[model samples]
Target: MVSFGDSKFVKKVCGITQASYQHGWDERNGGNVSLRLTAEDLVGFDDVSEVKRTLDLGFDAKVLSGSYFLVTATGRYFRNVISQPGLDLGLVKITDDGQHADLLWGYEDGAKPTSEFPSHLMSHIKRLKVDPEQRVVMHCHPTNVIALSFTHELDERSITRLLWKMQAESLVVFPEGVGIIPYMTPGTNEIGKATSDKMSEFRTVIWPHHGIFGTGDDLDEAFGLIETVEKAAAIYSQICAQGGEIRQEITDEQLGDLAHAFGVVASPKFLS
Candidate 1:
């Protein structure tokens, strides 16, 4: 069970998750997203049998506690996200202890959360140490982003450098820049480590042969950043495919100047 200090926040998360799902950005079962609300909400299980099964499946017991996590239910459809375009998605509240997880309202029966819950829960605990206020953490497999990720051999630092040239504010706005985690088998603790590490630096990460994960001050901003980075990557890929090279690479100084000019930090070079 997860507890929320604010019910409205939970509804907001549900709505955004649903909208992103509908946008064709979140392929079914391809990724998972979560938001951190309480930082210390209790983890929920169907019963003791579930807990034993989780442990038998090799999950740590410590991961069962967090403030509150908005997870995608196992093998569930994104279209059926708890909330719709203009609906209040509903709330599931659990206490600080794993006593109960109750869906306040707005969700129909048979709707389960995403299987990526453990990864989301673990990532939150790690990222909060860097930015305590970040709320929404999203994972998606946009075609262009994945395409770019697959075509190259990139370390997290290199990708951030690339994004910085293409958009600088994104490089440093959320503190650090983009991170690229090595591919991992999904729904495993191995991926959790990579996710946590990436979230600490930038708002987004591109998973090779996988997808991308993003976090933000809110859901809208987070999703927007994800879209922006994907667009940039798509354009870059198109240029490369055409046998054209990046026309110009801006210096850090110019990037800083652009950031100041925009009233926000962004990469210096654009489609000019």
Candidate 2:
């Protein structure tokens, strides 16, 4: 049997957490990540069904019952994940009843999953409905994206158009555009439901003045989605700092051509 320590999933979690910290996206424990896992992924791990403990999820996850997830622990700094994966990450299986999660491995120091687990789970549930391959949910405070929340209009259509024009790759990376949710207290069912609802139509959702929730089929895809938006936000920030005047930017027609070339459908509502 392969030890959990040597599992690829564990390594992936650790690597992403380290990268997030290095990029200044997850200061302290300000962000969280959760990756849905299939039974095939746990084939080599012994005692996969043994529950070390149970945690109340505060929301029913019946739809995800019997599924497994690897998530960063609550209050655990991303900076420490690479060096101490066992203490900063955990493997949990949603109980059949859906009211609790059974700890299967990791979180060796008795840490719990991130406070945003509900949001992550909700997102996972919603995304999977749209794309069966969906497997990852990542939340982080990208400096520029959060800054844009303060200076840019909160309307999803406006924010989507602005980010699409800020960089050439914006439309391709997030062709469906981004979702925006007004400021709300984090780690609650209300926020989770709001974010999840957005996930039904968008792969990325920005929590105004907070952070972003990105979903994808894997860690890199999810992280890249957030990274692309954040980079576009940063470019917009630089443009504003230079004068807040647009001399030239990607036009709607040009955006259409680019989207056509990429074979991706840019959000129609934002286009002329």
Candidate 3:
């Protein structure tokens, strides 16, 4: 059997995490990613059922029972993930009772999954309720997004509209708009709960003064959601840095047209 280190899932994690790090988004272990896995995805691995270790989850995740995930390790640097995936990434299966996890592969040096694992699982539970295909949760501290949270209003409508106005792709990419929750402590169940609650309505959630949470059917999709938001926020920041005089911008009507052109439904909450 091939080593988990060489698996495509691990390679994807390596590529995306490295890319996120290089984008100046996740600096010094500031980001984490988790991808849900199906039994089919684990089929070829020898000892797939072997538990290298068992971990306490510290919270009930009954909805996640029997599920498997590939996750970044806590305290592992995204910059180093590409070069040391075996130690920086791990494969785990939620215990049947959902109170613990069985480490199936990777985390070769004995490190545990990210402290944000609870948040990721919480996001998965809520998002899967709305989107059965949802499989990935990515959290990162993008400089631009965080900066916007400080300068822009915290309401979802305000943030979503500004982002939509900054780039036409913003409206097309997330026509349903984004959600924003008040700043909360990271890596805690409370923050996870808030994020997942918002995930029930939106694919993206901004944690004010902290970072952003994005969900998708796959890693690329999830990463793209966050990347798009950051791009819009970056443009906004650039405008603000240049003395912030808006000669003109993408109007709400234009955003509506963009949505219609792209066959997406603009969220009434933000667009109307």
Candidate 4:
């Protein structure tokens, strides 16, 4: 429950993530999104009224804590998704002493914390800077993206290259590089490593047959890149299935520009 910055933008991003989540794309109970927001407490419940205000403005507060909330909840079937009005949600708020965040309340049905809660917490407090003003993380399992990770015959490196070519923005934003972690059981320590290791080099990481974990300064930008990556993968899957080669690819220089636009970290020398 380390305190991080907050943002109204996160609420906006959560709204978008919820739409994608409930639409049968990320899979019911398969994807997760965590957003950091301005800290109201070193560790305390976020003003529930303010949370309500954000929701009134059409933000989704799935795992609302004090200053942070997860966009998705745990335990509910994706079909019976608790995505509507007046739904109860639980969150862990950081206490004022800068010690820890405690569980505040339960959403309708008294939902418990998500199994990926540790990952969410770590992403916010431990791994990367999960401040609201700085980062929004969305993790999902789009079918095509997950499908690419399950195969034995496909060249992993080549898969990303082809997908990036399909959407030039990916090549730039993720230009430092994308990574593939060997499969690990969902919500396990191993999976956390899979996520943590790639945090520095790439903003998004794919979990084979599982889902995607993405982060960014803004929520839409982060999630949008993921959608692009997913769409590109979908196209590549279709083309490769037809036994045809990808028709075009962006040069490394073009990728550099894309990364710069996204505010991705670059080596000191590259800055000059």
TM-score of 3: 0.98
Give TM-scores for every candidate, taking all chains together and pairing residue i with residue i: 0.72, 0.98, 0.98, 0.70
Q: What C-alpha lDDT does candidate 2 achieve relative to the native structure?
A: 0.92
In angstroms, the error of model 2 at 189 is: 0.8
Global lDDT for candidate 4?
A: 0.55
**Model 4 Cα lDDT, one tens digit per residue, 162-202:** 56566766565555445567678877655775576666556
RMSD of 4: 7.9
Residue 193 of model 1 has an lDDT of 73
Pick by lDDT: which candidate is best?
2
For model 2 the TM-score comes to: 0.98
Relative to the true structure, how large is the alpha-carbon lDDT of every model?
A: 0.58, 0.92, 0.91, 0.55
- TM-score for model 4? 0.70
Once model 4 is optimally superposed onto the true structure by TM-score, how far is the C-alpha of residue 46 displaced, in angstroms?
A: 9.1
lDDT of 1 by residue, 177-263 (tens): 567777788877788777776666556777787788787767788888887787667667777888958677767677667656766
Model 1 residue 132 CA deviation (Å) reads: 1.7
Error of 3 at 170 (Å): 0.2
Report the Cα lDDT for residue 144, model 3: 95
lDDT of 3: 0.91
Weakest 10 consecutive residues of candidate 3 by summed lDDT: 41-50
Q: Show model 1 residue runs off by greater than 4 Å.
A: 1-15, 38-66, 82-90, 93-107, 167-175, 260-272
